[model samples]
Target: MEKPSDNSGFVDSLEKLLQLCEELGQQIDEIGACLYPPQEISSIEAALEKIRNIIDVLRGMQWFLRLMRLGGLQGASDAFLEACNGLRSSLRELASEISSSNTADIEARVENITLTDK
Candidate 1:
């Protein structure tokens, strides 16, 4: 697997990280909420363990996205795959950093979104 080019790809900001958790919920059914506050993580390490689960879910979604691409959108799918690949690597790095308590590797990269309410 290709490694992330840099360490700046991790989703920073706890709020944004929660949102990504919700996105993961799309494929796994409320898993983000289920594994977090509502479920009560026992410790920081437990939280990191949950994150590893999210990474697995995201990787699965990438395959699902690849399988769903239509022929008419071949180019679009290719580009999307690039982003998906990047996310997987990013998540992997995040898991590693959290597991080892190495905040040094942390980088919060929000999705390309602008919140008007903010």
Candidate 2:
């Protein structure tokens, strides 16, 4: 029978998960800077491309986290798993917003509606 790996690998995976989370935050912040503080069109486009790449890596990290939890040295804590799931949800929301066309136009239209309602 093959011997199972020890907690060392599990600990390493946890570290990786933490690192990925930090990177994800940085990616989101970059996107915010591009959109907010309203930069040039070219800068926003470049930041968007970077966000897409980060998203691809984040997807892989999710898979890695799930696999580690399933075949881990020990079962991961509920809190840990929940936090990871939350991050995944946030990613989905971000994806939807970014994937939508004419976001600024839509925002402007919505603001006008709100003003009229007042």
**Each candidate's TM vs. the true structure?**
0.35, 0.46
Best TM-score among the predictions, by candidate number: 2
- The TM-score that candidate 2 achieves is 0.46
Model 2 spans > 4 angstroms off = 1-5, 61-63, 66-118
- At residue 94, candidate 2 shows an lDDT of 46
CA-lDDT, candidates in order:
0.47, 0.56
User: Per-residue lDDT for 16 in model 2?
Assistant: 70
Give the C-alpha miss distance for residue 24 in model 2, angstroms.
1.3
Pairs clashing within candidate 1:
12-108
For 11-86, candidate 1 gives per-residue lDDT tens digits of: 2323444666675546334323333333322343454455556666554554434543642656765765575566
Residue 23 miss distance in model 2 (angstroms)? 1.5
